[model samples]
Target: MRGKAAVVTGAAFGIGRATARLFAAEGAQLVLTDVDRDGLEVLREELAKTGAEIRTVVGDVSVAEDAREMIAAAVEDFGRIDTLVANAGIIPLQTVLETTPEDWDKVMAVDGRGMFLTCKYAIEEMLRSDGGGSIVCLSSISGLAGQSGQAAYGPAKFVATGLTKHLAVEWAARGIRINAVAPGTIRTERVRQLADEPGGPEYLEAIEKLHPMARLGEPEEVAAAILFLASDDASFITGAVLPVDGGYLAQ
Candidate 1:
């Protein structure tokens, strides 16, 4: 990844943050974006200590202008975009009856529409640059198979995975590779909170048992998969969804 320019969205925390750190350590210059201004700044300060070229833009991916600026910033800062980790997303676990119209729209706005905007602008930049690059979007096991409580979240990830395949075929002749990572239950802080909710412990225990590994995954594990798809190692791969699910999806 040395000398490569990359961009990571929703990079303030979880898989996004871990991906940024790994990218930096692997010698990629980066532009990170997220709605969390403070988290972005703080992450930048931390990554800077390692002599990595890191820049942050505060924006919501669902907003067109913000998404555009995020890609533009990468071109302006690092000269070209070699890779993009379109990881900004939100998951609201609720049954259809429990879901409100407004909140569902909000989830679609960010997780579904937001990813579309980011990929659109990022591909535009990559197309205009020296050569085509790789794009790794974060999908989920829910997108692969339906979940009981992910009425809205599952569909949004489906959109992301669908976009990856369409663009991978659409741009393959141009040397562009687009793929997605469908992660199983990753043990992030957000999941911990979900586990702490009412009856959540029992819920999580049951969830964990469903996995053949009988354990949740880690953010770094997903980040590692994202890195592989972004790096030259996956040169022959595109339009594919890699499952980092502790064999949960296999079941």
Candidate 2:
């Protein structure tokens, strides 16, 4: 990934942050964006200490203008975009009856709409480069199967899977590869927060038991999968949803 330019959204924490660090370690120049400006700045400083070329953008992925500006920043600063990790998402787990219309819209806006906007702009910049690039969208195990409390979250991820396939097929001729990483039970700060909520810990424990590995995944584990798909190691791979779960989907 040396000399390549990449963009990672929702990069202030969790999976997004891990992916950004992984890419930087491989010598890819990075453009990181997140709504959490303070955290983003902190991460920017940390990565800067490693002597990696990185630029931080404080913006909401749900906004179209923010997505546009993020891509522009990548091009202006790095000359071209070689990869994109559309990892921005929000999970508001609610049953059908428990979910309000606004809740559904909010999840859809960030997870579904935000992904669409990111891919749209990323592809535009990628096409300008001599060699097209790879794109990895963050889906979830919920996307491959149903979960009781994911009324809104599930559908958003399902849409992301569809988007991945569509982009991979439509852009294959242009050397653009689009794929998705569906993670399950990753141990992240978000998961910790969810576990602290009512009945959240029990729910998480049950999920862990269902996994054949009988353990929760790490954010770095998912980041490894994302990195594989984004790098030349996966040159022939496209339109596939690679699961980094501990056999959760299998069971």
Candidate 3:
């Protein structure tokens, strides 16, 4: 990834943060975007210690102008976009009965439309430069398999999963590779907070056992897989959804 210009949306924390660090270590110039300004600043400061060339865009991915600005930053600042990690998303664990119309819209806005807008603009930049690039979308196990309490989230991820394959086919002749990573339960900061909630510990324990590995995965673990898909290492691999799910999907 050395000398590559990469854009990672939702890059302030969790899988996005981990991916940014990994990308920097691999010597990629980065454009990181997220709604969390403070978190973005902290990440930028940390990466600066390593002399990583980075820019931050504090914006929501669901908004078209914001998505355009993010991709623009990469091209204007770095001169080209070599890869895009469309990692911006929101997960709402709710059943259809419990989900209100507003609830459903918010989830779809971030997880579904967010994926489309980011990919649409990023691919445009890639095509404009005539330098086809790689795109790694963040899908989830819910996108592949039916799960309890995924009424809203699962369908949104399905959008991500389907979009990945379609876009890959759309641009395959142009050298742009598009794929997705469907992760199982990962021990992100958000998940860690769950342990502090009532019944959260028991809930998580039960969830962990469902995985064949009987453990939650770390953000860095998923980040590694994202790196592989985003890099040339995954050349010739497109439209495939790789599961980073601790063998959960295997079962």
Whole-model Cα lDDT of every candidate shown, in order: 0.92, 0.93, 0.94
Cα lDDT tens digits, model 2, 3-89, are: 989999999999999998899899999999999999899999999999999999989888999999998888999998889999999
Q: Please list the residue runs of candidate 3 whose C-alpha ends up more than 4 Å from where it truly belongs after superposition.
A: none
Error of 3 at 109 (Å): 0.4
Summarize candidate 3's per-residue lDDT along 1-251 as a digit string, tens digits.
99999999999999999999999999999999999999999999999999999999999999999999999999999998999999988876678999999999999999899889989999999999998899999999999999988899999999999999999999999999999999999999888888998878987999999999889999999999999999988999999999999899998
| TM-score per candidate | 0.98, 0.98, 0.99
lDDT of 1 at 188: 76
Query: RMSDs, each prediction?
Result: 0.8, 0.9, 0.7
**How well does candidate 1 score on lDDT at residue 211?**
89
Q: Candidate 1 — worst ten consecutive residues by lDDT sum?
A: 187-196
Candidate 2, residue 232: Cα displacement in angstroms equals 0.7
Structure candidate 3, residue pairs in collision: none
- Candidate 1 residues 1-251, lDDT tens each? 89999999999999999999999999999999999999999999999999999889999999999999999998998898889899999978789998889978998899888888988988888889849899999999987898998888998889888988998999999889999999998887788897669878987898899889999999999999999999999999999999999998877
Q: What's model 1's lDDT at 215?
A: 94
Candidate 2 deviant stretches above 4 angstroms: none
Candidate number of the best lDDT = 3
**Local lDDT at 57 for model 1:** 95
Rate residue 186 of model 3 by lDDT: 95
